[model samples]
Target: MPKKRILHGRIVLKDDIISGYLEVENGKITGISLAKPAISTETEFFDYGSQYIFPGFIDAHVHSFSNPDEGFEATSIGAAVGGVTTFVDMPYDRPHPIDNAAQFNQKAAKIAGHSVVDIALWGTIPKVDGVSEIPGLVKAGAAAFKMSTFETDPFRFPKISDVDIYNSLALLKHSKIITAFHSENNEMIVELIRRLKEADKVYPRAHMMSRPIIVETTAVQRLCEIAKWTGGKLHIVHVSAPETVDIIEAYRQQGVDVTCETCYQYLLLDVHDLERMGPRAKMNPPLREPETVSGLWQRLAAGKINYITSDHVPWPAEAKQKGDQNIFLAPSGLPGIELLVLAMFDAGVATGKLSPQVFAQLLATNVAARFGFKNKGQIVLGKDADFAIIDPSQTTTITDAGLHTRTDAITPLAGKTLAGQVTATWLRGRPIYQRGQVVAPMDYGEFVPGAEFGNQLAPGGDGLVFEA
Candidate 1:
């Protein structure tokens, strides 16, 4: 018989939270009992008492290589400390994007060697004729395909043409794989920024003015129509407006397979923070007004939004300092993998606006189901024994010096006190993070293939030969 381990705690399940114990054997959950079970000398027992045992979080949006300084090793360490067992890395890497089977294979190899926690990869297409590479990447185990309506970099992150978008959707109509997008109107944002620069309005608020809510909503609406026409599944990332959720819901009601996710910053911080923190708080689809932020919280509580993500990007201080005088000069995004779970639990659950079950759904369950992580995201039988144990009585104060990421000073939430501290984190029944340190080896993580992986590959083939 395999060695068994039993953990006793306040387990948060799919429908309820109960005082119980969970049994693990060979890295899989074997049994769960609401009442305490008999512990024998053969089974190792660990008691957490009243601490909450949540399913290890899954952050759907992450950019480990966006800043080459912060690669899989550092990012995965931060993720483990934050109680995230699995994260889906974006395809927009620094030197070269993963847009083909060869590039995807290289990245997968890197993940296996460098990451300390499980990682799933996203793939993208090149600027021109990129849709042709989709099938190959899908076979290479890409969790999803990401495209952008607004071009950040012409070669690294290009805006997909309408024709290409339509073609890609049509080709993937039957695959059931999600094609996500950075939805913002490029033309409108460019024109607005041109005018702002001409008027010398380079203040922090200019970031919000250049890309308003209309820019995001308009692009989302167009994508929804295309998905409607081709029957492709669609996802919008880092949505900042409440009305955008309304738009997605309207399309969802019409039977279009459309979903949207909001980042934790959008819920915890408002446009005021963008102005207050300047470049440090800069991000694409900039933060919304305070009223809009409140409306977004209401939509989240109402279950109109599908899930939440960190959009974890760790840019250096110099990158953000460039925008100290001109907001647009700074690169967008901030580090969040190390703080997403703690911040959300403090603001949402500790405040009594959200229950523990809803918190798990937003951060873990929905992300797993949406991204096709079959073995993760729950604490039930047959699932991976991944957990984030939290002691609610303890509080954590965010600080740059305490961060595990490379660029710790780039976040605006530094010094914020959050309720509940992560006491330990387990990945596949192994303790990866405990008592403020990562205990797992760098190569402990494994690659998680997408749902369409098996269907795309030919049987008994080492190379990517598409199945007819």
Candidate 2:
């Protein structure tokens, strides 16, 4: 007989919150009942009382390999502790990016060996003439493609030229795979940074001043137009300014399949925090002013944003501290996969700005739908039995010493307190994290392929192949 277990809690469903118990058998949710079922000798049962039983959170943006010291083992462990059962790893690895089939396959193998929770991967193209690899990557199980308007590294995270962007989009227009971008105007930011450095203004605030809101809006607007023209699905990652959201909304209204996600820092922290915290709070498309943060919240409440992500980059202290006096020298991004769910609950749900259902949507449901993780996300029958059980009455204090990532001592959120605490996390009906311990094996996680995994590929001439 298949092993059976019962979990009782305040189940957070897609549309409603119910006081119910879920039945799990063979790692899948088989039945849900509002009333507790009769006890059976062969079944094990665990009751979580008033805690919220959320579908395991899915962070659509994570950088496990951005820092060579931090890899799948550390990031996935941190994710499990944060109640994130699965995450989509970015393609920009340290040595090389996943731009072709061989790289994608190698990364996929690494994920299966090291990750403790489920993981998906994003693919990208080379700096030029890389469109030909798209069909091969899709067949190799790349969840989506990521490009950039602003260049981070000329070779690894290069800015895609307009012509290449158009060509890539045209190729992926019918693949139903999203093409996400790190949208920022390269020329404007480069010029501003040059001027700032020349003037000897290396303060933390200068980082924001260098990459103003217009830098983001202009790039996003251009990408949206290209997506509209090519009919490609477009996604803007880590949107900070409200004006950028307005631009995305305008394009979305025109029937373009465009969506945007805002990081928790954008909604909860502001430029003031950046000025106060220095490089610790520093990230690309820097935090907006107080007014802009408020405006972003308004947009989120109005349902203009599709989802939220951590943009979790576990850069070592040396990488962030290098810019202490010269803020422009530090790399962008910070570690947040371990704090995203807890912090969001404290600010969005406990403050009543978001209900439990909406919180689940932003963190899990919408992410799954957007990234094509059909078997994960919601707490429904026939889905994987993954969950993040949160105790509303409990409190968690953030500290670098307590973090699971390799760069635990380098986050801006240290010493912060969040309202709720994740009491336990379940992945595929197995307890991966509970009572501050990671219970799963290092190789327990598996690679989750994207929506275009097994599609047929055929020649479309000009040395290009198209999904048939």
Candidate 3:
């Protein structure tokens, strides 16, 4: 609303950290100065003292509008407070699936006034390609077309056939919209499920055992080949295996137009946590062993994993309770939209798994480049004044009262102690979340579009946190 200056702190930028002041005017960053610039009395100033400010997080793979009761308002409450300013949501829903243009438009209408942060929508492959409106949805601004080799639902999420996938990729070959897949070989999973059940291995380990690394590797290997043949922009979602990263990296080295995203669950937790928490920690492409988890972290730090996301799923306690009787029956998703950035800062950044430069890349920079978010994912002039002012001086414990999921209960990550806490989140130069509360209006959020695969993306950034 007013010309403002963020002063007297270490400013984080793409390559070098400047101990300076940042200027914002009309919802955009206009300047970065090494010294306090002469200012008029009309200019408001907020000295950050010694806090670390980073670009607001962009989470790309979260489940929203997957049910009638679900919308962006409740989740964006968590997102805003938790430092996510933009999110690309999944296409599965109970009453309306985002398989066609009309359905996509209807869901967009549903979230019109409810979103509190920038929202992007994903479309899906329908059972019948003849009837599916992929081109129309793409023209209507779908971020990507999502399909799964492993079906999560019959009517809502049937597995796409290989022929269908190849045809769809061929159709999308030159299109800017990328094709994303949930890659797990369904046939192998079915057989493993049968064997695990016959042996009466009903423990949480069964979930992991049933879908071993091969399940993901095989699917990834095959999908890479299909994607190569069809020349479609391909991306794999919520990858859980180190081998999956290896496969994708190998393809990248070969110069394939492909990328893959991993989740916070795989990076922060392991099978033991799932064993203890049961279905609360249960998720597809399930969490791996301790060694595998270690390997994944190394891969991420080494820049093999393209980016990270929450894969934020919010299945109620009721369903998970039923899943407790049988891990297979347990819904596969862990709610983490509110915890992804903070928890990673706690585990990855503070522990030196990633430098601030690399951490920024993992959460926002790489994401923006991969998905073609030309406007965001960095703190720089001419971009939206979106940032998360973090208090890295103290520890914050995640608790039930601090969560903002639609369920209003704790997430799987609750009770974990994180290194830094987000004090405020600014979207378009406006403070939407502050002091552990979301203060933005329902109408503040708008839909953001993905640019072409090789769009002119914003530059990456790094920062120094001088002790106050």
lDDT value for model 3? 0.80
**Best by TM-score, which number?**
2
lDDT of 2 by residue, 1-468 (tens): 876889999999988999999999888998899989876998889899999999999999999888787889999999999999999999999899999999999999997769889999999999988887888999999999999999999889999998888877777877768899999999999999999999999999999999999999999999998888877789999999889999999999899999999998888898889999898899988987899999999999999999999999967787789989999988889888988999999999999999999999999999999988889999999999999999999999988778888744477788888999999999998789999899999989989999989785443233223468
| Candidate 2 lDDT for residue 63 | 92
Which stretches of model 2 miss by more than 4 angstroms?
Answer: 457-468
Q: Which has the better lDDT: candidate 1, or candidate 3?
A: 1
Distance from true position, residue 168, model 2, in Å?
1.3
Candidate 3 lDDT, tens digit per residue, 1-468? 476655446556787666688787787888878878778886777667787778778899888756456567888887897889999888887765788878878877766788788888888868766224666787667888889998778768888888778777777766667889999999999999999999989788889999999999999999998877656678999888888889888887777778888898898889998888888888898888999998888888777888899988777677677778689887778677888898998998788777776777788888887777778888888888888777778788887666677664336777878898788888887789877677888898888865532233221111111357
Candidate 1 lDDT tens digits, 113-142: 798899999999999989779889988889
- Report the CA-based lDDT of candidate 2 relative to the real structure: 0.90
The C-alpha lDDT values of all candidates are: 0.90, 0.90, 0.80
Any runs in candidate 3 off by more than 4 Å, and if so which? 1-8, 130-132, 408-410, 452-468
- For model 1, the local distance difference test gives 0.90
State the weakest 10-residue window (summed lDDT) of model 3: 456-465
Top model by lDDT, which number? 2
Clashing pairs in 2: none
Residue 431, candidate 2: Cα error in Å is 1.2
